[model samples]
Target: SAGRPMTAINSSYYAATAYRSDRMPNQPPSAERSWIRRFAKFRLPWGLTQEVALDDFLIRRKPSSLRFQEEMNKEREEKQKLGTYIPAPYEHVNFHDRHDHESFRFSLWSKRSHFWIYLTGGGRGLFYIAFVVSMMTYFLMLFALDDPWLTTTVELLPILATWIFLPLFCWALGALVIRYLPHLWVKPSRGPIWEINRRTGLVTLFDYDNNGEYKKNGTIGELTAPFYEFDAYIATIPDRQGLVTNVLYIAHRYRDIVINFRPLFAPGEGQLCCALWDFLQNYMDTSRPLPDLPRYEQYRHLDPTTAEYDRKTRRNPRFWIDMNDATFEQELYAMRGKIDQIDTFQRPNLMARHVEYVD
Candidate 1:
């Protein structure tokens, strides 16, 4: 599986450092995490450190192969024919467009807060409905029925005050609590918890203690490693009902750092996760053109290798931008078929040349 060494981008020292072999190990073992540990890890907040072991399941270790490129190119060309071949970078993945071109940042706490809001908000909504129904019933009795027990304006005054003021006060208090309560448990992160930088070929993770407190002074919690120095894995976890959940994780080959962007992809998208792994390799490999997704279309020229490739091939600058929804859906359905046909494990690990492996 030995191949030509990576050529440094613009002969720059920083870019050259990404290709260093000293930090990588020869052979990484397949260490399956226990179901109990997986369950506990899933419950942990995102900013807290989740390190990897050498024995963790290893999926990808190097740049993608020609076969992988051919499959992706085939999908891109199919979309290009439909005029819906736009850049669908990480930012656009899972229908979220919050990320910038230089990096894709993800935070689990933000997602957790949203989950809590949905739950607590539902209960508050029921309370509002009950109050409305009760008020309607009370008014109907006082006006339409003309009941002897509810006759005068003075009697109505106290009843109306009770109905209006009590519900309004409760609703207002509930709203305030729902808005601020989650912040007390998990502090709103100052920035993204995980970031993958396209320009630097580096992946960074910010760590916090179990209590969700920043452990480092002046942002000392930031841990970064070369993109090529990590391996991808699928952590299959089963819930209490015996339903299995597949989570895609990336673990540093030498360091204890590990990160997952589960919120970016929906549950049961294991194949899509595999495709994402291939996309990351293509995007980070300076030797190849960037993945032809709609998000990267505008920034294609910024990457030296991608710019040169587009120039030599005369690739359309608006390939992804000029796409339509209908054709894009058609092409996406077909692309998934291609993705399913691919055997991610069939390809040899090109990391063999990039790192030394031991028995």
Candidate 2:
């Protein structure tokens, strides 16, 4: 079993400390937010501060010879044939591509912002292109059929609605895609930057690709939370059997917007999540308990791999939109505030005594 066990400490996570720990605990928790106390006693109880600044990172690794890789590949093939390869839910190291061995930075905001995972202009293009192609294919097939199964497939003036309005539909979809894109996208190597302002506990996201310079409008996302909200949503990863595996998702969240791109966007399993979680563990309340990982269950709540997670989002270019529109924004905030705080959060810390790389 080559699975990377969940370690108590990951040094790689702590290697990029933006501020000293001694100075951080002493700073006034959230000084910039004093303007709100004047109006009412509505304070977000999640002790936030402004002492720390998330700046940069380092990914350390050791290379292996080509012969070693060949040997490993052969071993992997044999395991596959024998059905004994049990893959770890997430592996931070990309052994095949060497991508796991790189460093990147977090993007920040001009004001209160929370964690952000950006889809670049190029990434957006790929998204729209794939979406448009799939949609076009489906619609074309529908028209060719003698009749569609769905009741909404009515012919409301076929020449005007179906033929003429088809272009309009495509235009609208394309516009939506463009709206979600940053002006440019950074190379995957540089990655997107994420900042959690100590002052407000809010997360700010910066794109190193299109907005690396941190222009006035460089920020792609800003989300706020009141106190603490807790829940376990299912993250789906495909399996060899063609079905998907359901795992408990633990990452940054604010109401409907959840940011855990570790399994998808980050190189390897997601080193940043490990690092960020480790950092937060020091500041966050520990009396509360975190959600348990699953034993055996199918995911039923949200599916991040779909188009609806984007299209159905409130604003076209908005960051961290809800998985579903049924929940009201205010209700979400209230629900989060009412729920007990939990830090299912985990980050790699080298000092954790495990001799493991802090994520």
Candidate 3:
């Protein structure tokens, strides 16, 4: 009797709220005028930006309650497990090891392997071009005859022959090189080898024991390195002295340089490390003069320690902490407030006040 009465009371309360004063207005499907006015006022320094209506932007079109509950459940589970709650498709921060002694040696070999691969590719390409030119020359001579039908027939034969035979020949040549060239060029070195991917920015390193056997403990894979989209195809072979010394310097300077030294020479692994290392070194070298600062007047009052000063140093108005400073955490939190203010000013459309309509 008690359960039945409680259920009836709850149902009545739900029915009352279902058509309550909080219900949205049933207006005609038309563009929002206020949004148009805001859009007209919103002029990007570059030019007039695209218009986004308020109804379309602010309307809660999707069912959010269930999704929010699921997200909360996921976060609770992650927290209970003592794991940081990362959104789907998260990337783990890569940590480099500073303790390894043979890291530089492996890096050098990896760079050498990349150079060899590049040289081989260039040779093959030149050979193919020469073959093509030769075919074109022969066809030109053959087609020099006065008979139009015979010339056409000869041209067709050359084209067909090239399309079929050249590819097969090249494949055979490549197979031969792959099978025999490693033995010839890759000498029995007594250290770890590293490699880089030319297409993907994947890096690998492998270490060998005293007997020249690849040690299981030494094998490492998928070392993350800074690789730009364009660096995918090009391979750089570092000069023996310059590359080895620089790698050693980096390893010594940076306490955390997590890299697998064993798989460095494997295809597609070594070159990426070389490219990334070069880029970072160039980027971080304070010896290089800073570029001309924009909006320098806005940041003149704040000291270098202040977030406002740092924002002025860069055009993007984002604050970055100097890693070398002892009060990094304090500086970071101070910058966070400044960053929030900048974000609010830059993205005004995102900060909309929730409005409830009453009948």
Question: Using TM-score as the measure, which candidate wins?
Answer: 1
Query: What residue runs in model 2 are displaced by over 4 Å at the alpha carbon?
Result: 1-24, 28-41, 47-156, 163-190, 195-359
* Ranking 1 against 3 by TM-score, winner: 1
Candidate 3 lDDT over 176-236, as tens digits, reads 6655665433432334344333212223344344243345454443323321211111223
Superposed on all Cα atoms, the candidates' RMSDs to the truth, in angstroms, are 13.2, 19.7, 26.6
- Give lDDT tens digits, candidate 1, residues 134-164: 6776667667665575354556657666666
Stretches of model 3 off by over 4 angstroms after superposition: 1-135, 143-160, 163-165, 168-309, 312-314, 318-359
Top candidate when judged by lDDT against the true structure: 1
* Candidate 1, superposed: residue stretches over 4 Å from native: 1-14, 19-101, 108-188, 210-220, 353-359
Error at 294, model 2, angstroms: 5.7
Model 2, range 192-217, lDDT digits (tens) per residue?
A: 44443322323334433343443455
Alpha-carbon TM-score of each model against the true structure: 0.56, 0.24, 0.23
Weakest lDDT window of 10 consecutive positions for candidate 2: 291-300
Report RMSD for candidate 1: 13.2
